[model samples]
Target: MNKTVNQKAWFLVLPVLILVGFSAVIPLMTVVNYSVQDTFGNNVFFWAGLDWFRDMLESERMWNALGRQLVFSGIILAIEVPLGIFVALNMPKKGFWASFCLVLMSLPLLIPWNVVGTIWQIFGRVDIGLLGYVLAKLGVNYNYTQNVIDAWATVIVMDVWHWTSLVALLAYAGLQSIPDAYYQAAKIDQASRWKVFRFIELPKMAGVLMIAILLRFMDSFMIYTEPFVVTGGGPGNATTFLSIDLVKMALGQFDLGPAAAFSLMYFLVILLISWVFYTVMTNLDKRDGV
Candidate 1:
């Protein structure tokens, strides 16, 4: 006789399916509807076909925003990944100091994103902000609002300060998973610090590092509120990444069709990059028998 399958689990999953339908699928379908149609006013929609998508593809403004977004994400990954790995490697392996270090590393990650933005906005102000005041006192030109370089620097630094801790924490967890036997073997072999890291620690942390990269990349690529709160995509659109530009199109200019199309393309780019990363990671795992 055939064993009975647990068909009852569908009942348990039904609520989640309903919730997802309302929260994600419905809204996504609405966006798809808008993306292919244009509206004048009073809820009158005209079929625009692929016009909006074509316009977004050909628009220089969108391309420029895309370029800036890529650069910002690249800079974030470059700084945060290496810095996080370094911090993780140096963290205390055991005891009270380890606990203390872990707590310290976690503090930044716990702060609200908008609050982080607000804090940085004030903190970089030239008037009463300590950082700005000190920089000015030291004869440094530090003004995030008025200058492009200052705006970019402040945004980059703010992002680094806020998110580096996440990378460190993930990397630390990866480090914690390595058995002491590996370190002992390395020590017996008289492995230098670099060799231990290269041949042992790095390989062990590869899984988590991949995770860290993907997380940071996606977050940085979609970054909005922090930079918005801080720079407002100002100084001649120097910090106007894709999200800001999309918001501008949707709300600022009231170009709903273009905005919807832009959003869909944005979603696709993230999906594509994430898929690539996942595929590479899976292949690497298989190669290493992981």
Candidate 2:
């Protein structure tokens, strides 16, 4: 006789399914509908077919935004990943300091994205902000609003301050999973600090590092609120990544059809990159017998 399964579990999952349907599926459907059609005032719509998609594809603005986005994400990842790993490697393994450091690291992650933007906005202000004031006192010219390079630097530094903690925390967790015995073994082999890290710690942390990379990449690629709040994609659109461009097209310029198409393509690019990361990570895990 076959054993009975917990078919009743479906009842518990039903609410979550409904919530997802409302939150994700419905909005997604709405976006799809808008992407394929054009609309005017009074809720009137006209069939546009693939016209929007074609236009977004051929648009130089979209390409420029996408290029800027890729560059920003690349810069963020390049700086953050290595810095996070280095910080993690130096954190206390056990004791009060460990707990203290962990809590400190998590504080940045706990702050709201908008709040992070606001905090940094004030932080880099040329008037009363500590950073700006200090830099100016030192005879340094620093103005995010006026200079594109300053705006980009401020955004990247803000991101590093806000989210590098996440990577460090992940790497720290990966470090924790390594048994003390491994360190003892490395010591027995008379391994240098770099040797221990390169041979033992790095291998173990690879999984979490991949996760950190994926998270950082996705977050940086789609980043909007912070930069928007700080720069408003100003200084001649120097920091106008794809999301800002999408907002500009949809709301600023009030071009719905092209905006929707641009958004869909943007979503696909993110999805595709995320898939590649997931595939590489899973394969690495398999190879390492993780």
Clashing pairs in 1: none
lDDT string, candidate 2, 188-287, tens digits:
9999999999989999998889889998999899999999999989888999989998999899988888888888899999999999889988986798
Residue-level lDDT for 114 in candidate 1:
93
What lDDT does the true structure give each of the candidates? 0.94, 0.92
Each candidate structure's TM-score, on Cα atoms with residue i matched to residue i, is 0.96, 0.94
What's the lDDT for residue 170 in model 1?
Answer: 92
Candidate 2 vs. truth: CA RMSD?
A: 2.0
Query: Least lDDT summed over 10 consecutive residues: which range in candidate 2?
Result: 281-290
Q: Model 2, which residues run further than 4 Å from truth?
A: 1-13, 288-290
Q: On a 0 to 1 TM-score scale, where does candidate 2 land against the true structure?
A: 0.94
Clashing pairs in model 2, backbone N/Cα/C closer than 3 A: none
lDDT of 2: 0.92
